[model samples]
Target: MALQRKDQDILNAMSLVESTKGELQKLRDNGWDSLMNKVSSFCEKHNAEMLVMEDVFVDPRKPRRKTNITNLHHYKVNCFYTILDLQLQEFNDRFTEVNTDLLICMASLSPLDSFCEFDKEKLVKLVKFYPDDFSYGETLCFEQHLDIYIDNVRRDERFKNLKSLGDLSCLMVKTQKHLAHPLVYRLLKMVLTLPVATASVERCFSAMKLVKTTTRNRIGDQFLSDCLVCYIEKELLDSVTNEKVIERFQMLNERRVVL
Candidate 1:
C-alpha cells in the first residue's frame, strides 16, 4: 500500500500478480491431462466402456433409445477431451509465431548478463519485426552501432553490475548516448512502455469488469473513461487533497470552497 507509483513499483506489482496467476494457471495447463484421465477413471467406475471418440461438437442430450445408454460415458469423456483439445487450439491461435519471436527478442534485452545482448542479428530481427517503424538506413545503422555500443561500454566499471532494462536505459541516458543510438533507444523505449502500458490496461479492464458488471453495464463512456484514469493513476489521486478538489469545484460555481 505504501509503494510509490514509480514505473518499477508498478511493474513489480504487476509481476507479483503474474507470478501468482501463473502458479494457478499451471493447474489449467499441466493438470488438465491427469485430471481428465481421473475423470475417465471415474466414468469407468460408473460402467463406462471404452469407445473410440470422434471430434465433434455435441451437447449432452437424453438418450432416445435403450441401447444408447451404454455409450453415455463415451459421450461425456469425448466432450471433456474435446473441450481440452479446443482450449489448446485456442492457446496456439493467440500466441502466434511473430509474438513468440518478439518475446525472445525482448528477453535478449535484459542487462543482467553484463549487457550481453549485443547481438546484432537478434536486434536486427527486432527492428525488422516492425519494418514500418524503421527506415532501411536507420536499421542498418543500428545494426552496426549495436556492436560498437556494447564493446565501447561493457568493459567500463560502471556498467558491470547492471540488472534490468530500465537500469541500462538510465545509464544510456545518463551518458547521453541515447542520442547517438536513436534507433536502439527507440526500441528500448518501446520495450519499457509496452509492457507497463499492457499491464495497466489489463488491470483497467479488470477494474471495468467490476465497475460495469451486467447490472451496471449502462455506464457512460465518458464516466467510464474518467473512472479508469483515476483508478489507474490512484497514486496521483492520493496526493490531491480534498481542499484542492473543493477549490476546483467552487471555481466551477463561483463560490467559496467549503472544505
Candidate 2:
C-alpha cells in the first residue's frame, strides 16, 4: 500500500521495501511469543479450543508415524517459521542485490526534498545499466553535467520542495533547464520509464479483462495494442478532439470532398 501511493517515488519505494524486509526478518526471529499470544486471545474470544503445546500432534488423514511430535513443533516449526521463511524468501527473490542497487541508483536522482538524495556516483552507475541510452562519450559528459546540474537545481528556487519525479521533469521542461542539461534530462527520462512497482502492470491486466471480452476475443495484436494504449492513456487521449482527429486523418490522404 505504501508503494501504491499516487505521490510515491523511487526513493520512498526503495526505502519501504528495505524496511519491510527488515521488519519481516525481525518477526521471523522474535515474534513467535507475541504472535501466539494474539492467536490465543483471538481463539479464546471466538470460543475455539486452543491445543496444548505439549500435546502430541496427530495427522487426521495420514497414519501416525513412530516418531512423536508435539503441538509446539507442529505450529512453531511447520506453521510459524515456515510461513515467515517463505515470506522472507519471496522478498529476497523479488528484490535481489542487483535490483536493489538499481533502485538505489535510481532513487539518488529523485528531486524530492531539494534533491537531498542526489548522488553523482550512483547516477553514473545507473547510466551503465543502459549503455544504449548513455554511450561512452555521453557517460563521461553526464558525469560532468551531474556536477553542474545538481548545483544548479539545489540552489534554484523552482526545484525546491518538489514532490515527485514527474514534477521535477515538468518543472525542468517548463524552465527550459532540460535544454541546458540535456544528458541529465535524458537520464531522468530513462529513470522515469522504469517500473518501481506492480500497480500499473496490474491496472493494465484489469483493463485487458474489460477490453478483450468474449465478443472481442478475436481482435488482432495490432488492434488490441492500439485499443490498450488509448484506454490506458485516457488522460492524454481526452485532450484530443474529434475535429482534430478528423483533420489529422484527412491530412493523411488528400480528400476528394472538403466536408
Candidate 3:
C-alpha cells in the first residue's frame, strides 16, 4: 500500500508537469534551458518516467513575427503558478510534521519579531489544537499586561519546576522593563519573537497610499494596480521612465482636448 501510494504521488506530480508543457516549451525557448534540465533531472532522480502522448511530439507553427509577447506572458504566468503550488505543498507537508511542543515554542517566540503580525485569536487556536503539549497559562506576554498572565502561571506550583518557561518569563519581564520607549520596546519584542523578519507589507501599504490618494480618486483599478507595482518595484519601473510618463500624459491631454 505504501509503494502504491508513492507511485500515485509520482503520477500526480508527473501529471502536473505534463499539463504545463506549453510553459516548459516557452522556458526552453527563452534561455531557461537550465530550468528544463533541472526538471528532467528531478524526474530522473525520483525514478519517474515522462509518459509523452503522440500530440506531445508535434509543435504548433510559430508566429511569423520575431517577437511573441502573448506566449511569453502566458508561459511566465504558468511557470510561476506551478512553482508556487509546489512550494506551498512542501511547506504544508513540513508544517504538519512539526512537533507540537516545538510549534508552541514557535508561537511563543514569534511575536518578538518586527515582521510578525500579532493575532491573539490565531495563537489561542494554536494552543487549543495542541492542548496536551502546552498549558494555556504558560504563555508570557510582552505588552498589554501580558506579564499578568505570566505571573498567574508562575504562581501555580505545578509550573514552577519548568525552568525553561520560568527563565523565559523572567527574561521577558526584564526586557520589557529595561526597554525605555514603550513603542520601541513593543517593536523590538515583536522583532525578537516572530519568525517574520521583513517590513515589506508595511512598505507596500505606504507605497500604495502614496500612489492612490484623493487626487487620484478616479483612477481605474487596473491602472492603480499597475501604478502600485511600478512604485513598489522600482527596478521594473526603470524601463518605463519620465519620457514614457510624459508621453502618456500628453496623449491623455490631447484626447481630453479633442473631446
Best by TM-score: 2
Arrange candidates by TM-score, descending.
2, 1, 3
lDDT against the true structure, per candidate, is: 0.67, 0.86, 0.47
lDDT of 1: 0.67
| Candidate 3: tens digits of C-alpha lDDT, residues 41-115 | 988999987433222222246545343334434444556546655655554454333332234333442322221
For model 2, the run of ten residues with the poorest summed lDDT: 58-67
Candidate number with the higher TM-score (1 or 3): 1
Q: After superposition, how far is residue 240 of candidate 2 from its true place, in Å?
A: 12
> Which of the predicted structures, 1 or 3, would earn the higher lDDT when compared with the native?
1
Evaluation by lDDT, superior candidate among 1 and 2: 2
TM-score of 2: 0.71
Name the runs in model 2 displaced over 4 angstroms: 42-48, 63-67, 112-116, 131-141, 151-182, 220-259
Q: Per-residue lDDT of 55-84 in model 1, one digit per residue for the tens? A: 333335733434333333544455544665
RMSD values for the candidates in order, in angstroms, are 7.8, 5.3, 19.8
TM-scores for the candidates: 0.56, 0.71, 0.22
Superposed Cα deviation of residue 166, candidate 2 (Å): 4.9
Kindly provide the TM-score of model 1 when superposed on the true structure, using C-alpha atoms.
Answer: 0.56
